[model samples]
Target: MPSPTKETRTLSPLATLPATMQLHPPPSSGTHRTLRRLQSAHSLGAKAAAQPSLISQQRFQAQNQQQRQQFQRLQPIQQKPPSPARRHVSTARSPQRGRANSDAAPVPTTTQLAAMAMTATRRSALSKRSLAADSMSLERLLRDGPPNDDVEGALESARLKILDQGIRSDSDGMSSLRIYVWLILLNAPVLETDTYLSLIHRGPSPAYSKIRNDTFRTLTTDPLFRRRVSEASLIRLLNAVAWTLHDTREDRTREPSIASIASSSRQSLDQLSSRPGTGHSGYGSGQSHPSSPAAKNRARALTLTTEGSETSMAAESGTYVQGMNVLAAPFLYAARSEAEAFIAFHQLLTKELPGYIRGAMDGVHKGLALVDKVLAIVDPRLSLYLLSKNLTAEIYAFPSVLTLCACTPPLPEVLRLWDFLFAYGPHLNILCIVAQLVMIRTKIMDSPSPNKLLRSFPALQADQIKRTTLAIIKMIPDDVYAEIVVHAR
Candidate 1:
């Protein structure tokens, strides 16, 4: 007991303690294994918690990417309407990297692709005289008797025949007869080359500035128009017409004796504008509008001569507007010479549809309104839907009405439509406008933004428009048709 060793003393104390209270260390291998198991379990729990969030984040990114891609697909390219020379461009989908999965849906065919492929029957030129010969035939029929004879019966017969068979086909080349046919329908007097030559020699027109600005841009996208038509020719033709109008007005103002003629003409103008039947009953219908009213008024009232004058008459008829160049393009394309084109274009503005190109373009505005009215009549449901979205004719049909639907592409189709217009009545254009709305009524009603559909109307299906137009015409009342006659003039 005296001064016992430390080990012995510690052993003596543990012997006094209960065996259960004693401490002992486990084997190193066992302790390490237990710690490893705990660490593995904790890590497994952490991974399980993070997996859901990671998967959700990836799914959201994929969804966002898909929406972006869909938006890109829906965005339309900024382009003029489709042209005849432009063939169908395939929209077949190429396999995208992330999107090519087993769950992805297959691509579907579009109605538009089918429509684009279905072009109207194109006419071939049998000979250069085909169009002119047809015109001559029509002339003989109309002039079968005296000039003052009741040619209405004969005129109606000829129109029906031409409408059934469009002014010669434009199969491979331009139809030489289209110009003559257009001139005949317009009742424009035949002119010698000297008339146009004289006008050109007179130098720049009072509207030269506006004409020059628009000439280069006319139908720039159409291959035929761009390649075949020279800017110089268009400028010259428009300038000459402007000069003729200016010269005529200046000549009229200078002669006091013509004052009485002018007064009577103005009175007649007031009457024609107010009374539909008294005016030209058919626009582009091959029937002549009395010259005393339209011609005299244009000459006397629209004194838009030299230097863009601000007089009411000058403002009404003075400088060129935005779409005149486009309006003149079809004329130049069909005419053999500037003289022929000049006569047609001049008569169109002054006699055929004076209100269209006037300073205010009131006739164009009226045409737009009539388009809306006609649509509402033909398809009330579609019209109401469009009206609800504020998509009126002015927003979409302005160019079509202003250019007689020539503003849109597939030049061949436009030429065909013009054939119908010339043979029947440009007033039929209103019916044509209604037909357009009817053709795609479903798509328009389904669209969230119909303006996009209207901004540039769907490509011209000449046959479809003509067929639909003819059917619509039969349904229209005589009174409404009369209103359409005067709507643009």
Candidate 2:
């Protein structure tokens, strides 16, 4: 039997199996045997699906054991709760310090009361005089107010803290506490999920799906924990994630970040994870393949469609996507693959959409369609977003994920919608985007009309574009969401 050529890899299973298919050749004996074996293995998959190859299982077990050991090693240095004796000891020390803390006596004054009053009055008047000045005047005025040698030190600290916060926001891994809380959270009889244990013990593995799915069943058992992780809170979490993804170039480049709208978030170092071995996980250490049959099918239907990464995103929008490319490149490629899957999902949703949803998300659908065309050359269903309409000229949907939430008005509400989009399927997120557009339709339409300043009103950054998109989506009836819940996503 002749060896199969590279072209064979290009055809899909259904396409290749049919006599009408011409791209792939009839399988040679060796190729035929390979196909038969693949079919046989696939048939046996349901039985062994819960398990894996002995090699993989053993490796997983050993990895799990090592993770347990590492978790043990990582267990935080737990502080013992204060005992009564310790309280007494602290009490005993307080009075002795208090007695010593006071100054012994007052020194005699050198100046008169009138001079002191005059000095104080002059300084007050001078402060008022200085404030009513421009930059240069303010600079000179600041010099007159007080000695500022330590101001340099204070400024340096501020700079350092700012840099640290920036680092924290971008971190996807350990920046501060993740485990200390886990250790305590895990031991509480009614507080934690086995989900906490699995990550700590196994790191991260592709095999965690079953464990996580099982854990999901137990999530409601811990009422307090459930409340802590409510949809509202999860939306807050997504907001954090959106912030974490913040790139200065994208998020705050155009508009000033409204200080009033956003609270300053410092990186929390005092996490429950201050204690070691508390909550970290080893699951997801292994690579993740696409889970659904469609994903697998998509893999076979390979394309050069690059995943939507900051770079590719920037390229599409004519901006330089910041950050290290290596870390982001793989994900971008994955996004391209994700986009392909999204288009296929979009196809399914289009077939199933209720009349209203189909009508409302027209532009969003158009965007998805555009995404499909862009990725069609590579493969469709890469990293497509069914973006809700952004009608305000003040802000269009910001390009990168970092900038997306930053540009929205009802940001907290917005991020909650984004959370499930990424959480479920990568490409299937188009539905959530569409849903949000519908949700915000009225707010957008009521906002001031788009600036007609631009020659092309329907441009990407058009003022009413988002609202128009939303209005379009508003037409989708609730019944359309059934498809979203069951299949679209």
Candidate 3:
């Protein structure tokens, strides 16, 4: 066979080709189109697999766009930008942003609101206290006559002010007017510097050795007292008081006896009645008129009797006592000068608390007894508990009685308590003592040894003490309260 043209040439079929090996029947047109479609699909899948990140990025962008549209729909409407000419005009009219929305401040939290309220309350209270202190100035009250010339009314007003609004003090707790108020309350007369100096020049008293021994110990622990008052000043004041007391004792001793005066007067009256003209018609008749010699003599005898009783009482009181130092400390601390302190101290010893300094300290003993009695009545359970433990006011309340609670610490609080005591009556100190016992009754009862607990009292709190004292006053019987009043005297 000759080779045919390229398009028409056909090689001779291999002889008897196996049916399995025969050339595949020419593919049908439908099958060929199906195969072409499958090829195109496979090619597209391969392209996507080759660059997956690009496809993923495109899908992610589509999702983000949808989210942005949703978010924009929820946003507040925004104003359009102003025209350039309008903006220029607006800027010229107003340099700063308007504050029309300034009133809509953010709401404060609960704690912030509470803190603001507390600050405002504190300011209001401080203002009220300042005004009250100024209005109740004791110096001003003394300089300007009392309103309506009511001295007692003015004093009451001052006391109420002291109670409601405490006296204003400097940072050191010193009050300029406290001494003056104390002088007025104590009725201490003004003394010349010369008088105090004269007493100082007279050298130490008979009690000087004893006074010296105590001088170093007076308020030894109180920094304020030590800073303000010196040992020499205390010595001078105490020595002056001792001299006054010594002179008083000597004067009392020199006084004529009532019995002698009475006997002498009786003898004179007898002789006068024995006279001829004065016999039956005069003193002997016992019908003498008020102006008659017999009546005058009798009146004089009665006066002597009254004076004798008073003298005997004075004689019982000693010139100096162990606790007088403590008693004088507050006066010294409060006074502006030694002379002032001297006046107050002398007055207190001779007038207000003479009984307390008696040779036996009978008044202190009485005060202690009154404390027990008052406690027994006011709080029977506590009183019974104490009694069972062999605890008596005598054991626990001696210094309190002797010093008028000046033995307590925190001199400022003592000063405040003194204000109340001097204003009302020093006798109320018994009530105050009882009030302290009542205040700690629960603690005392709980303790196994109350004596140890009461050995030294807790620090003074003037307000709480006063309130408790007032409450105790209401509960006590009248007789016991009266005893409390006079026991100190």
Candidate 4:
């Protein structure tokens, strides 16, 4: 009920702490400095609290004045109109030295405007070219129909069409034309379904397990390949080819050949003539039978050598290899039917690229050496750089050679390249392998670690490769190209 005392009213919040709190000694210099700042802040806060409206208005006016200054600086300066020549000269003089002022409006120079126009025009031209290219239809190539006698011209025309305009990809519903063009290029005649079915009916091949192992994994990452071609279908086709190869080998082995017999007899005679006391010894000497271990060992060795030659012949004829699935995948993907795929694949293996799937894979090795030789000829600097680092083509290009460059990603691009190779000659694949190195020569040379770069080559840009491959054919000497022919054989 009574009025408050003056002493009580003057007591501050800090004053309410117990005297025990102040019993500590005066704070250290750092603590004392912090205390002074706190005291100053407290006094300023109290003063601001006394006239909050005035403080807010002052802040608002300060913000407006700053904004007005910014706005004034942002306004563009107008100058007397100058002659066109002076305008361009003035723009050309401005080199854009450094970071622009934050307050000033950006003023593009006449040179910048010209550059922008040029870039826009370039973009428009590129777009038009692309549109023109897309406008070419598969029907156009087919409408001309295939030539009967002039095979080279027909092939040349088809290749030109493919280069100018990509094939109708499987994504498009018009792959029938693509298949037809491929058939023509491959020189693969359309096979009857009955023949293919009969091959399949021969049952699973000795290579069936190998085919199944590879079939599912073929282009597993390729959506187009996976979406269109089923693994089961691929397995069936490979198995049928295996049976055909097996049957053919069996037929050849069962049939007697005079050449084989004569060569074998000549080899035995040569062996007998080579050994001491061994010339027609059965006529007078005691040894007619292979009774001694030494004689028995010699006889066994001859048998093995004969068997080895026969095995090698059969393998070179048609036995499947590890990478054959990848080699055949592009064909199967492009071909509409299993029979077409089988015939194309068979032709590719037996005729086009026989050495690739052979027991020794001699073609792959030769191709690797050819890659080195071709690269040395085309891009001598990059080739030497790689060789200096011991990064031979055998280390990096084995897959490329074996698969005929189909192992590269973006299956669509690979297919386009094949159209070119098949139309001309699958032999051109060696040139293509060289083309990839040419495209990325700069990157490889610049990198400190060339092995890392060579470990995985860049993705295929088929158009670029097709052009480069063509260019390489001209760049390389005829002798080198001849070597390319002999390398794969």
The lDDT of each candidate is 0.55, 0.24, 0.57, 0.55
> Rank order by TM-score, top first?
3, 1, 4, 2
Least well predicted 10-residue stretch by lDDT in candidate 4: 274-283
RMSD of 2: 33.4
Clashing residue pairs in all predictions, respectively, total: 3, 59, 0, 0
Error of 2 at 312 (Å): 14
Query: Model 2: which ten-residue window has the lowest total lDDT?
Result: 273-282
Q: On lDDT, who's better, 1 or 3?
A: 3
49-83 in candidate 1: lDDT tens per residue?
43323334334335444543543343222222222
* Residue lDDT tens for model 3, 102-153: 2222223345434434433322211111223235466666556355544444
- The candidate maximizing lDDT is 3
- For candidate 4, lDDT tens digit of each residue in 178-217? 6566655554544666767766776767777667656767
The ten-residue window of minimal lDDT in model 3 covers 274-283
Q: After superposition, how far is residue 264 of candidate 2 from its true place, in Å?
A: 39
Model 4 clashing residue pairs (backbone): none
Candidate 3 stretches with Cα past 4 Å from truth are 1-136, 252-315
Tell me the TM-score of each prediction against the true structure.
0.59, 0.18, 0.59, 0.58
